[model samples]
Target: MSKPTPLSGFPEWLPAQRMIEQNVVERIRATFELYGYAPLETRAVEPLDQLLRKGETSKEVYVLRRLQEDPGARTDDSLGLHFDLTVPFARFVLENSGKLQFPFRRYQIQKVWRGERPQEGRYREFLQADIDVVDRDNLPFHYDTEMPLVIGDAFASLPIPKATILVNNRKVCEGFYRGLGLEDPDQVLRTVDKLDKIGPEKVAALLVETAGATDAQAAACLKLAAISTGDASFVDQVRALGVTNDLLDEGLEELVRVVDAGTEYAPGLIRAELKIARGLDYYTGTVYETQLQGYERFGSICSGGRYENLATSGNERFPGVGISIGVSRMLGLLFGHNALTISRSVPTGVVVALPAEELRPACDRIAQALRRRGISTEVAPAAAKFGKQIRFAERRGIPFVWFPGADGEPDTIKDIRSGDQVEADAATWAPPAEDLIPVVSKA
Candidate 1:
């Protein structure tokens, strides 16, 4: 048989890299919990109809089927792996509405799949860290501004470079489109969403040919998309556009509130970029797109928005605002570029070396004693020369090597890097606090 080959989009990281990934996840989880958000998880598969509710993402949905099926089995209702966490969360809220509390806040970090072709930062299977606030009815508008702040906290705790969150509201886009005398505002929003992929020239042409916008209207849309400010100054810029509509007025006010809060709380981190039309159909309010500093070409590493009517059941509407960090994608890009690092490969802090195979029991006892003291300890695989034992610890990035006491002598531990040998009792010995756990940092 031929040697096995690795898949392109399915990422597998080395031991040190996985350590960095775990640290990132823990930091994000801790931040989410600090804000009073509970943890949640949803199954991987959902009915095909539910997955296809958003028409644009249908092409990326991956369906699952058994290799062998009964000849007469019915296949009317099919299943597909969920392309995103938001869809599954919406279903969970509707299914468990009665059991959950009002204004439910949840943080979910899980793997999601998409069948789209992967390139650069995009992946077919990836991990996402998502936090959302859902309400039974009449969701508070203040939650819209709070979404980015939560994301800001999570990202700030990680070792990666800073991220700038670009904010936009669907009401802003729709109102401006209607004010321009455009009949289909949704189509215009979708077209404008492609501004990053295709240049503004192509977007403007498509707006005219597909969305039925006049040259002046398309220009106006382009101009609106170009308005981005670090604070509430964007409101004055939009007002300067000379557009007047009730929805536009309302959207402007809401955008101002969100921008002002972000400025006051997470100053210089949030920006009001009017052209950020989130492509998702369900997003009826504020939308977000995040760009990592010095990595803008890879596109948004995190994004989400407010959905006013995403989850509904028999007259009860659940509206929510959320943000999702594309964890796998971010890590993959950083790892590929050698931007992340971990000081150690394995969790073991010290390796106990046996002078002879007969001292296996003693080595085991020493390891156990250290472990009870909250220290990570491992025993050398076999009895070998002192130099060989030291090499074993060095190869795995284990900082220290412990020699088992012979003939009733006290235990001695050697700091492998410095070759400093010190006598100590197994019960009271401890590694430095910084060396207890692997250190992850930005390279």
Candidate 2:
């Protein structure tokens, strides 16, 4: 037999670490449900064509096939593990459009696979917590504003560091580039999106070589990307840039609406960051990227955008706005830094001590009573000396140990950590609220 080695990009957490992850997920799920979003789950694989229809994600799709299938079978309709929830959701909406109502809102928490090089906060397989609102035909612009507020509330409920959501509208970038007389706005956006990675000098060169932009036009594009504001004042800043176009004006108005809404509701949570050109071709309106306050270099721990035409049924269009929390990425960074604490490694609150194998039935009854009252309890694995039994509870961090009464005496319990043993009844005894379950908190 060989020792097991870890796969590079797949993350596996210890029990204490997993408790923190579960706590974070529950908080996010509760926040999503509080905002009227219903839960949803989609199949893990989608047709490769549908997964590749939206962006430059073709390289990231993990294609699937049956090992015993014919080798010469047609591969055009091959299936691949979904890289993100949005694409499968779009396909789901289109497939079930007739049964679904208008303005469908859903929150999905599932593992998505991507074939990419692993890093500190990036993984080949990861969990994504996503929320999206899709409407028939014309989707309201206000949904764009609503997306970040929900995300803000979710992050607020977590134990992680504060998350700042950086927002921008595609129309703003495309219109600004067109206003500067650049013919290939999309190419320019794709180039500028790498500004953080390649820097301004390299991005400027790529703009000229790839997007066919003149030096002055590339400078204007860079200038637009540099505009970031905490409020609607960004509207005036863009105006000051001296570029004029109707689409740019429309985008500015939409972005200001989002920023203003964020200000009134979740102040200091959202910002108009012009450089957040999401590297997806499907995004037609506002885009978002979230940065954990001190872990900015790890890149966006949450991201998504508004796509007006990702799902279509002939003349009908299902436009939507969404955001996804990179659950694995955030946990990876936090766990790597030892930023979370768990009160206990296991959820057990009380361990019914076994005095003898003959009294196992009595101990089982005591365990059932504690569980009936909502206290997580387990019976001792073996009948051992009282001292050995207490050591067993302490080893697993179980707070209380119960001893069954013998010879008509009342049963008793012990708080092993404090050595506080007292006569008690299994039917009436209960631990304090905090000790009933494992508590997860910031270290």
Candidate 3:
């Protein structure tokens, strides 16, 4: 048989790395829960038409079908893998609106499939952690402001260095574009989205050549894209653009609101940027992208925006604004480099060694008691040499090695990191509180 092919964009980690992934996800879930956001999980597959209801998103979606059957086989029909949590959540809310409470706060953790060309930091299959609030008619503007800070806190709490989240509003970009005479504002947004990839000079050339923008218009667009500042001066700069369009002014106001709210809570957390052009067509209000401080060239590790009327299940609406954390891309930076980390996987609090064949039950009992006391314990698989067993425990990063001393000491625990071994009883034995819980990287 030939060797298996390496699938692009779908990253798989070793056991240790998976433990780190688990920690990252659990932290996000915990943060969401702490804020009184209820958890909801939707089915993995939806009707193809429902999944691809949005014409633009349909292009990137991957349709799922089994290949074992004949080509002419009577269909189980076209069912596609859910692309993102937001779309499926919309359909779920619409299908079950009666069951949901208004201003429904929810967090969804699931895998979404996108059939785009897989490249570095981009994936065909990945886990997305999303939290959004879907209101009865209009999603609260405060929810729009609060979502980013909550997400930023999750990143800040992680082992990664300080992260900066750049936020912009789609309405603002659209208003500015329409005021500047681009009837096809969507096309202009698409061109601007590539500003980081192709550089401003090239993007300006493309705008004039393809988007029907005059040199002056292109120059103005380039100038607007280049503006990013910590202070409110950006508000003045856009005002100075002197293109008096009511809609443009409205967009600018929306930006001010989002930036001000973000700043009030975290004080210099959100950066107001004019050039951020999020690629998704559905975002009608706010758009966001996150980059690590020294890892900007690695591109946006997380991004999302607001959508006006996203939910339509042949029923009422489920309008929402939320963000997604690219678990894989973030980990790509997190696992290997100095950016982020967690105490090793196999975060075993205690490891019980087996002295002989008959001593195994005691080891099991010891492990069970430790686990009952909220300690993660692992018992040696076999009666092996003490050196070998100690290595096993050490390899797993198990801090405490409990060796059964039947005669004098019933339980003896060892601190692998410090080589401190002590005698104690299993029922009352306790490790350091920090060791009981694994150490994770932080700011």
Candidate 4:
């Protein structure tokens, strides 16, 4: 048979790259659990109506259907692979609201699919790591501040480049546009969100054409978008724009709180960038967009926002704030650039040397002993010569090779890289802490 062609959107990493990705994900999970966020997993598909509730996302949803099934067999056509985690999470909360505690904090790491053209830092199927805080009735404003701090800490623990969390609030944008007499703030938002893709001139033109704004009003919106600061100074900057409304003031106060918390906790990690108008309509308050340093053109590698009414039950509202790290996008970009490195391709720290086929069980016992003490060990595949066994470990980046006791003599271990062999007992011996697992670092 001929060689199969490679698929464009689905990424499969090499063993070394996979090791780095797993290390990065474990670090993210550790940071999330440190903050008391419980782990969660949700179904990959959601009802079509639930997926379509968010504006402008229908084009990205991958519908699910069985092959050879009659189209008219079902009364309703209502299932699609979820494009993002937040929507399904909202449904999960509503479905199990009774069994959950208020202010549910969850961190979900899973694969999400999108039916869009794949490019650099974008894929049709990718892993997303998300953390969200949701509560019945009104969710506290502090969660908006906390979301970025958590993300900042998570990214900080990883070896990737620094990620600056750019923040904005729907209240601020909507109130400012309303003060300008523009009736459709959402249209203005969707247009301004294209500023990074399309230039400011085109965004302003689109605003006038699509949002029904005059050229001057469009210019004013650009001015607001241009206001970015590392501290609460953004509040005064927006005030200087001469837009005033109760909602604007409220948003300004909430944004200041978020930025100030960021300053006090993770300085220089979060910035108030007014241009980050997240296109989702559910974001009623704060919105966040994260740009990796030196990879800013790849777009936001992490993003999410505060939603006041995404989840609800009868006469009840579950407000929430969240942020998601594009795990696959991030690793893909890094791997493409050759920016990440791992200590080895596999996790085995020691390969028990096989002297003869008759001694396979003895080697297996040695491996088991090492494994019981939290060491990663494996037996040599063949009863090759001693030198061949050492070379086998070297090829896979395995640090040590263990030889079983000759007759009644104590067993010995060899660090192949160093050519140092020493008498050791499997029941008591251990590799150096750094050698126990693959270490991921920036190249």
Global fold similarity of model 4 (TM-score): 0.97
lDDT of 4 by residue, 18-95 (tens): 888888999999999999999999999998988998778988999888887787797366699999999999999999
Tell me the lDDT of model 2 at 73: 95
Instruction: Compute each candidate's TM-score over C-alphas.
Output: 0.98, 0.97, 0.93, 0.97
Tens digits of lDDT, candidate 2, 1-443: 79998899999888888888888999999999999999999999999889998889989999899989899999999999999999999999999999998899999999999999999989999999999999999898889999999999999988778899999999999999989898989999899999999999999999999999999988888889999899999888899999999999999999999899999998899989999998889999999999998899989999999999999979989999999999999999988888878888998999888988998898999999889999999999999898998888888888899888889998888998898989998778889999988988788
Model 4, 146: alpha-carbon shift in Å? 0.8
lDDT of 4 at 196: 94
| Each model's Cα RMSD | 1.1, 1.3, 2.4, 1.3
Query: Which residue pairs in candidate 3 collide?
Result: 159-441
**Candidate 2 local lDDT, residue 283:** 95
- How are the candidates ranked when ordered by lDDT, highest leading? 2, 4, 1, 3
Q: Report the backbone clash tally of model 3.
A: 1
Error of 3 at 208 (Å): 2.6
TM-score of 1: 0.98
Per-residue accuracy of model 1 over 162-195 as CA lDDT, tens digit each: 9999998889999999998999999999999999
For candidate 3, the lDDT comes to: 0.80
In model 4, which regions exceed 4 Å deviation? 75-77
